[model samples]
Structure formats: structure tokens, C-alpha cells
Target: MHVSALWRHPIKSHGRESIESVELVAGQTMPWDRAWAVTHEATQPSAKDGDWAPCHNFVIGTRTPGLAGLWARLDEGARRVTLRHEALGELTFCPDDAQDQARFLDWIAPLCPANRSRPTGIVSAGARGMTDSAFPSISIMTTASHQAVAAPLGGVLEPERWRGNIWLDGAAPREENDWIGHEVRIGGAVLRVEEPIERCAHTTANPFTGQRDADTLGTLERSFGHQNFGVYARVIEGGTVRVGDKAGRA
Candidate 1:
């Protein structure tokens, strides 16, 4: 199979960006993917040290679906991000700057659920990234599998709801899910597939509209007997992975 698309989320649960390529490191997340995440008031006590914490500790799309509509552009050299949403307009800031963090919080205020703990600030684990998995992982999803789920739902579901790091074409539905413990190669990188990614409520949100328009979890449960949609794996060898590169069990 070949990689049909590549993407990254510079700030966890905040925004997503499309990319042509990225240099991945062994045992590390895709560069700048989920590089920073915001902690809520309730989670600050345990998450303030910039260490890995459970995803629920953060203000995320699962709780605030409106955040899913965000699109982002990154200036890698300058360490600045430009985030845009139909409701919130746009913001460009370096995540490391205190002032910038405040600006981002202010800009995203309208999207956060008022009932949940307020987002206090941003934290970073540097190269480790704050992925949902305790082990640093990259999520790989197939378009065919996406279609398999969408077919019964009118075939209108957007793949963005999955927020996968790499999207492959030419694989049958659920084909990669069987690759657990297998070594796979794409471009110059080698990776080990670890486990299927059991999805959450976040998948129900529409990326373009930022609304929970579908019952993805329920559909997966009824249709597939599980709420899984993608596979998560760790890079075993560091190298450049680019769009359209051949990838599969190696």
C-alpha cells in the first residue's frame, strides 16, 4: 500500500495540519505532532510538570467538539503556529511564549465547554509529545477502512474525525488491524504496529463544522463489534516518511 496523506497536530486536541513529509525518530511521535497540550484547572496539579498524563486531564475534542474544526499552519523554524476556525477566526503565536499561550487560551475560550474545568495553560514534554497512548505512538489508518465504516452511514463521513497521522490507500478494510506485532516500512522509516486504536466520542464530531453529527462509536460497536478505527504503532527506525511512499508489512 502507499501513503495517500500525512498530517500532524502541533498542539494536542487543538488543531490539525496537513504536511507533505516528516522526519520521525525511533520511539518518538511525529515531529511537532501533539508537541504541546493544555492542562485544565482540575488537572494542573498532576500535569503541570510537563509529564505525560491521561488524555482526560486535558481540554480535548472529546469534551469540546468545537475544537475539531480548527485548521493549522506551522512555521517550523520560528516555532510559531497559525490556527484558524470558522467561529474563532485566526491566531498566530509561538507556543513557548507566555504571552502567546495566553492569547491562544483567549482565542479558544468560546470553544471550551463551560462546565468542564477551565484550561489553565500549556505544557510540553518536548520531543516525547502528549499522545493518548502512554507509549509514544503514530496512528495509521486506511481509507478503505474509513469507507467501510462510512458506507452504512451514507458514505459521507470525513476522515478528519479519525485524526490519524498517516493515511494509506489500497488496503482492505481492517487489514492493518491484523498487523499487530508486525514490522511495517514506509519511505525510509521502519515501525512496529502495536495495537488497534479504540476510538472515543471525538470521532463523532465533524471536522468542517465542529459538531457532533454522527454516532461513530455506536456504529463501530454495532457494525464491527468494537469501537476501533485505526492502529497505533511506534517508530522502530528513524527516517524521512513522505506522502505516496510505499508502506505495508515488511
Candidate 2:
């Protein structure tokens, strides 16, 4: 199989960015993936900077589906991001800046549900990114498996629904599920496939429209007997992975 696409969510559940290549590090998540997250007014004890926290304490797409509509581009050096949404237009700011965080909360307020926890602030976990899993994980998916799920639902579904980090192009449907406890090599990086990534309400929301238009959880349960769509792997060997790089069991 070969790499097809790569993505990163600089802010947890807030925006997604596509990249042609990325540097993977051992025992760490993809650089800047979920590096920062927007905390809510209801956050208990509050999210402290330079510390990891569970996803529920923040504003996420599951509770506010409209957040899925966001598209983001991150400038790693400057810590700046340009985000766009059909309804909100565009915003450019540095997530680490206090003033910019306020601007971001205001910019995204329209997408967040008033009943849900109101967006309060943004925080970063330093080198330890705040992925849904307690440990750092890189999400891996394949087109064939995506097609398997989409076949029952109709045509090809937008891949962003899964929010995977690395998408492989050639593999049999559900073949990745059998890869647990094994190692997969992509370009120069070697990673151990640890576990299947369970499905969440986030997948039901359309990324472009930010609407709950698909029943991805139902489709997975009915067709695959599990609410899972991809695998979470931890990098064992750090290296560069680029689009079109060959990938296979190591």
C-alpha cells in the first residue's frame, strides 16, 4: 500500500489541515496534531497549559457538529493558523496569543451550541499532544475500508469524516484490523499498530457542511459489527512520511 493523504488538527475538534508531508517522531503524535484545544466554561478544574486532558472537557464536534465545517492551515514556525468556514468566513491568528484566543472564541462562537459548554480559552499540552487516547496516537486509515463503509451508505464518503492522520491507498477492507500488534513502515518511520480507533459522533457530521448527515456509527455497527473505522499506531521509529510513500508490514 501507499500513503494517500495526511491531516492534522492543530486545535482539538476545531479545525483540520491537509499536508503533503510531515515529520513523525518516536513516542509522540504527529507534530502539532491536537497540540492545542479550546476549553469550555464548563471545564472542571479548567485545562492547564502544558498538560494533557480528556477530550470531554473541551469544545468538540460531537456536541457542536458545526465545528466540523472548519478548514485550517497552520504555520508551525509562527504558531499562526488560518481557518475558514462557510458561515464564518476566515480568521488568521496565533493560537498561543491571549488576544487571538479571544478572537478565536468569538469567531467560533456561532458554530458552538449555546446549550453546550461555552468556549472559554485555548490551551496547549506542549510536546505531549492531547489526542482522545490517553497516550499519543497517530490515526491510520485506508481507502478500501472507507469504501467498505461507504458502499452500504452509497458513494464514497468524505475522508475527513474519520479525521485520520495517514490514509493508505491500497489495502483490503478491514485488513488493518488484523494488523494489531504488528509494525507498519511508511517511508522512514516504523510504527506499531496498537488498536482500532473506535467510532464517535464526530463521524456523523459532514466536514464541509458541519451537519449530521451520515449515520457512520450505524453503518459500522450494522456492516462491520463494530463502531470502528481505523487503527491507532504509535511511532517506534521517527522519520519523514510523504504523500505517495510506500507502506507495508515491517
Candidate 3:
């Protein structure tokens, strides 16, 4: 198999940015991926301590599907993020600045579901990204598996909905399921497949339209007998991974 794409989400449940290459470090999520998240006003106090916490402490796509429509670009050197939305235009702000955090809150407030708690501030996860799993991981998906899921849905599903960090081609559908406890070489990095990524309500929403137009979880259960689409792997060897690089069992 070969790596077909690489993507990162600078902010949790906000937006995804495509990159040609990235350096993977052992025991860490992708650089700037979910580095920051918007904390809701009613979030638990433990979440405000700037440490890793469950995704429920922040505004996420599952709760507010409109977040899927937002896009982002991160300027690591400048410590700034520029967010774009069709209705909100573009806004750039430094996540560390208090004022800028409030500005970001204001911009996204309208996008929040009316029934949900509103965003109060942006929270950082420090060196570790705010991933869904408690342990740091990289999400991996295969083109054949995606097509298999799409086949039952009667439509082409967008890879963005899976929000996978690595997309591979030339693998059989569901082949990665058997990769657990085994090392896989992706580009120059080596990773051990840890577990399957269970499908969630977030995948039901369209990344472009933010509408719940697909029953992805249902389709997975009916077609695959399980609610899973991707695998989460922990980096074992650190190196730069580029698009088009070969991927195979290490």
C-alpha cells in the first residue's frame, strides 16, 4: 500500500488542513493536530487546567454538526490560526492571547447548536494533542475500506468525515483489522496498530454541509457487523512521512 493523503486538525472538531509531509514523533499525536479546543461555558472545572481531558469537555461536531463546516490553517511559527467558514468569512487569532480567544468564541458562538452550552474560551492541551483516545495516537484509514462502507450507503463518503491522519491505497477492505499488535511502516515512520476506531455520531455529519445526511454508524453495523472504520496506531519509530510513500507491514 501507499500513503495517499495526510491531514491534520489544528483545533478539535473545527477544521482539517491537508499537508504533503509531516514528522512523526514517538508517543505523540500529529503536530498541531487538536492542539486547541473551544471549551464550553458549562465544561467541567478539571478541563480548564490545560491538561488532557475527554472530548465532551469541549465543543465538538457530534454535538454541533455545524463545526464540521469550519476550516482552519495553522501558522506554527506565529502561533496563530486562521479559521474560515462560508457564513463567517475568515478570522485569524493567536490561541494564547486572551482577547483573541474571546474573539474566536464570538465568531463560533453563532454556529453552536441553540440547545447546547455556548463556548466560553479556548483550552490548550500543551505538548499533547486533545485526541479522542486518552493515549496519543494517529488515525489510519484505507481507500478500499472507505469504498466498502460507501457501497452500502449508496453514495461516496468523504474521507474528511473520518478525520484520519493517514489514508492508504491498495489494501483490501478491512485488512487493517488484523494489524493490531503489529508494526506497519508508513513512509519513513513505523507505527503499531493499537485498536480499531469505533464509528461515532460525528461521522454521520457532512464535513462540507454539516448536515446529518448519512447513517454511517448504521451502515457500518449492517455491512461490517461493527461500528468501526479506521485504526489508531502509536508511533514506534520517528521520521518524516510524505504523501505517496510506501506503506506495508514492518
Candidate 4:
């Protein structure tokens, strides 16, 4: 198999950025991936304390499909994030600043879905990211598997719905399932496949349009008899991985 694409979401449940290459660290999430998250006013106390909590505590596409429309760009040097939407234009701010946090809240208020807990503050967890899984993980998916899922739906599904870190090609549909508990090498890095990634309401939203246009989770359940899509892997060796690199069992 070969690596087809790489992605990072600097902020959890927000925009995604495509990259040509990325450095992986042992037992860590992808660099800058889910480094910051917007917590709702009603977020649980444990989540408010900068601890990794469930995805429900934050403003996510699952709860507000409109959020999937936003595109995010993180300027690590400037410590700022710029978010843009076709309808909302753009807003840039430093997530670490109180004033900017308030500005961010205001910027996203109109986009928040009705009756959902509103975003109140931005939170960070330093070098460790606030990933969906309690353990640090890098999500991986294959083009074949994606095609299989889309075939039954009679429509193309965007890979963004899976929110995977690595996208591979040349693997059979759902072949990654057999890879659990095994180590795979991609470019110079080695990762141990841990578990299958379950589908969520988040996948129902279209990343490009930010609308609940597809029933991805439902499709998975009906067709596959299970709500699963991708696989989660933990970095076992630190190295660089680039698009087009070979991937195989380590």
C-alpha cells in the first residue's frame, strides 16, 4: 500500500488541513492535531480542567453540522488560528488570549445549532492533543475501504468525514481490520494498529457543505452490520511520513 494523503485538525471537531508530510512521535497524536478545542458553557468540569474529555463537551459538527463548513489554518509561530466559511467570511484570533477567546465565541455564535450548548471558551492541553480517544491515536483509512462504504450509498463520501490522519491506497476494502494488534510501516515511521474506529454522528455531516446530506453512520450499520470505518494506530517509532511513501507490515 501507499500513503495517499495526510491531514491534521489543529482544533478538535473543527477544520482540517491537508499536508504533504508529517513527523510522528512515539505514543503521540499527530503534531498540532486537536491541540485546541472550543468548550461549551455547559462542558463538564473534568473537561473544563484541560483534561481529555469526550467529544460531546465541545462544539463539533455532530451537534452543529454548520461547523463542518469552516476551514481552519493554524499559524503556530503566531499562536493564532484563522477560520473561514463561505457564508461567515473569516475570523482570526489567538486562542490563548481571553479577549480573543471571547471574540471567537462571538464569531461562532451565529453558526451554532439551536438548543445546543453554546461555545464559551477555548481550551488547550499543551503538547498533548485532545483526541476523541482517551489514548493518543493516529487514525488511518484506505481508499478501497472508503470506496466500499461509498459504493452502497451510490455517492462519493469525502474522506474528511472519517477525520483520519493517514489515507492509504492499494488495500482491499476493510483490510485494515485484520491489521489490529499488528505493526505497520509508513515511510520511515512504524505504528501499531490498535482498534477499529467506530462511526459517529459526526460522519453524517458533509465537510464541504456543512449539511447533514448523507447518512454515513446509518449506511455503515445497514450495509456492514457495524458502525465502523477506519482504524486507530499508535506511533511505535518516531519518524517522518510523506505522501506516496510505501506502507506495509513492519
Candidate 5:
């Protein structure tokens, strides 16, 4: 198996960016996989009775079709983060301070009016109103799996719909879901694939436009049976990974 692509979402639920390479660290994540997200204090139409929380508080979905177009870049040092959009100005955040968070919230709030219906940051430290499935952090998908999911459609689905942090290519399609609870090595790093990442409504939100689309859920449900497409891993070692880095079952 080989890596065909890689991605990271700086802001948890906002959008995603495809990458040629990335670096991994244990107990943390690829540079920007879940750095930010949107939260809802009250139950959303999708969540039913679940109240919103911070990015740290909940799991966001990547299965949503609308997030397909969002893209981003983190400066070489992983300090400056830039979003790509026409009307919206690019904003940066300091992961270490409230000042940066406030700036990011202000910059993002006005752009996503639909998010207004949901409540803001969670009262808990580092928690947000959004919720995600059972991964401590980070989501991954394979190019072959992506192609498999898109095969039925007679073409490829955009990467944004999957919203993964790392994209592995050349591996058997859907191979990731089967590797849960095992360790795999990629480039110089070793990681333990922990679990299959479940899908959620956040996938419905367009990271670029913030529009909600429900088709993504139905597609995943029909193709994969469960509302899931990827796996979660805890970095066991740190190293640089680049495009074409070989990923093998450990």
C-alpha cells in the first residue's frame, strides 16, 4: 500500500485541505487535522436531543458532501493558517492564547450564518459545541477506498466529502477500515490504527459555503453500510511524511 494523498482540517468542522505531505507526532495529530471547529449549545436538527459543544467536546462528520471545496494552508512552521475564499478575508489564530481564538471566531462567525443557530464554544476548557464520533483525534482515508466509494457513481467523489487528515494511496481500497486495532508504519512514523471513524451531520455542512446537504449521509450509508469511511490512529512515533511515502500494514 502507498500514500496517494494527504489532508488536514485546521478548523475542525469548517473545511479541509489536501496535502502532498505532513509530519506526525504522538498523542497529538498531523499539523492541522482538528485545530478548530463550530459548536452548538442546543440540540441541532440533525443531533435530535444532543446539545452542541466545543471541538474538543464532540465529533464532526466528514461525510457531508458540502465540505468538498474548502481548502487551506499552514505556513511551513505550522504557525500561520490561511483559508481560501473570495469574499472572506484570511484569518490566523494563536493556538496558545485567547486573542487568536477570539479573532478566529469573529472572522468565522460572520461567514457562516447558518452556524449562528447553534451555540458557541463550550464552557469546558478547550471544548467546543460540535461533536464527533469515537476518535481521540485525527481521521484517515485511503485513495483506493475513496475510489471504491466513488466507483458506483462511475467516477471519483471529491476528497472534501471524506474530510480526512491523511490520504494514503496505492493501498487496497477500503483497507483502512479493516486495520483498526493494529499498528502501521508510514514514512518514518509508526501509528496504531485504533478505530473506525463514524459519520455525522457535520459532513452536511459545506466547509467553503457552510451550506448543508444531506445526500452525503445516504451515499455513505448505502456504500459502506455504516455511516463511516475511515480510521483513527494514535501516533506512536514522530516523523515527516510526504507524498508517495510508503504505508504498509505493520
Candidate 6:
């Protein structure tokens, strides 16, 4: 198995950005994966509630294939982000304000191209219940795992389908699953493997084009007992990560 790629989503449930390399540090989370998600203003037991706020909350893959096309960059100061997409021109979202949030959502919605009507304003889901249960501030995966799964499915798997915060190269196939309970050193940082990530419908949704293909799910179930193909991890040390950094089990 080998570490082949890395990625992060600046805005939750929107899209992902692939990187040649990255550093994993403890405590410091990656730019996006869970940085933001949409939620309903009124409390409801079901996630399907239509009263939810827009882009500020999490998005579903069933509606927009383009939502997966999101890409972003963190400024040198690591304080702001520049968002981009094929449909929408480049834009930025700062960590400020109600008005700014509204504009951010409006900008994002058009680019997302979701089938459903989206809200104009974006709101936070609060700190609690804001992310997936397996979400760690940072996560990692192996290229071999991608190959193991993709090889069976016509030799191509979009990185966006997995939605991982970090991608690694130069590791054994499916090696991440074996790293559980171990702290893996990545670039100048270290991350502890928490558990194997469980599969979800989100995996079947293509992040780039926002298209859904049932065959993707069938391929996963047939190739791997479970649809899951990655793991969740937490940073144990802090440091900057860039491409070409060495990754290995600590």
C-alpha cells in the first residue's frame, strides 16, 4: 500500500481540494471537512427537515453532484479561505458576520448546483453535533486502499468520493486499517488512528460532478465486506504539513 493523495474541504458538505501532500499535527484541524455545516433553525429529529438553513449547514449528495467540485485555499496567515468552482467564479469567506454568511451561501449555492431549492443565508449548526461521528479534526488514508477498491471498479475512483481531510502516498494497500491504536507520523506531525470509518450513502455520491451512481455502492459491497474504505484519526502533535512529507506508523 502507498500514500497517494491528500485532500481537505474548507466548507463542510460542499467540496474537497486535493493536495500533493500535507502535514498532520495534533489538535489543529484541517481547513474544512467539518468547518461548516447547514442545520434547520427549528429542532427536528430527522435530518431531512426542509426548514434547515442553507450552505451554513451540511449538504446532501443526492441533490448536487457539483457540490463535490468545491476547492479552497488557506491564506498565508491561515485565517481566511479562497473558494473556487467551475460554475462560480472565485470568492472568499471570512470567519465573520451574519451578512457575510448570507453572501457566502448565495455564492456557494449557485456553484453547488443542487437539485433542491437552497436557502439564501448560512448559519452554523453550533459546535456540538456539527460533524460526523467519525470526524476527527484531521483524517488520513492510503492510496493502496483506493487501488484496492478502485481496481475492481474499472480502475478509477474519484478522490472526491471519499471526502477525506488528508491523503497519503507511499503506504501499503488498506494499510490504514492496520494502523488502528497506533500513532502515525506524517510530515512533521503525528495522528492516532481511532477506528475504521463506516460507509455511508455519501460515499456513493460523486463530489466533483455531484452525480450519483448505484454501481459505486455495489462495487464497494462486493469488493469489501463493508462499503467503508478509510479510517478516522486525531492529531497528537502540531506542525505544518506539505506535499512529499514522509508518512509512517509511529
| Per-candidate clashes, comma-separated | 0, 0, 0, 0, 23, 28
Q: lDDT of each prediction vs. the true structure?
A: 0.91, 0.91, 0.90, 0.88, 0.61, 0.61
TM-score, each model? 0.98, 0.98, 0.97, 0.96, 0.72, 0.75
lDDT (0-100) at residue 150 of candidate 1? 94
Cα lDDT, model 1, residue 162: 96
**TM accuracy, model 3:** 0.97
Clashing pairs in 4: none
lDDT score for candidate 1 against the true structure: 0.91
- Worst lDDT run of 10 residues, candidate 2, spans 42-51
Q: Which stretches of candidate 4 lie over 4 Å from their true place?
A: none
**What's the alpha carbon RMSD for model 3?**
1.0
Shift of residue 92 alpha carbon in model 2, Å: 0.5
Tens digits of lDDT, candidate 2, 116-146: 8799888887777888888889999999999
Q: Give the alpha carbon lDDT tens digit for every residue of 1-250 in model 3.
A: 9999999999899899999999999989988899998899788999988889999999899899888777789999998999888778899999989999989888888789889988888888876899998899999999999999888888688878999999999999999998988999999999999999987898988887778888899999998789988999999899999999999999
Clashing pairs in 3: none
- Model 3 is weakest, by summed lDDT over 10 consecutive residues, at 151-160
- In model 5, which runs have C-alpha deviations exceeding 4 angstroms? 37-69, 76-78, 86-89, 92-106, 110-135, 154-156, 204-214
lDDT of 1 at 95: 85
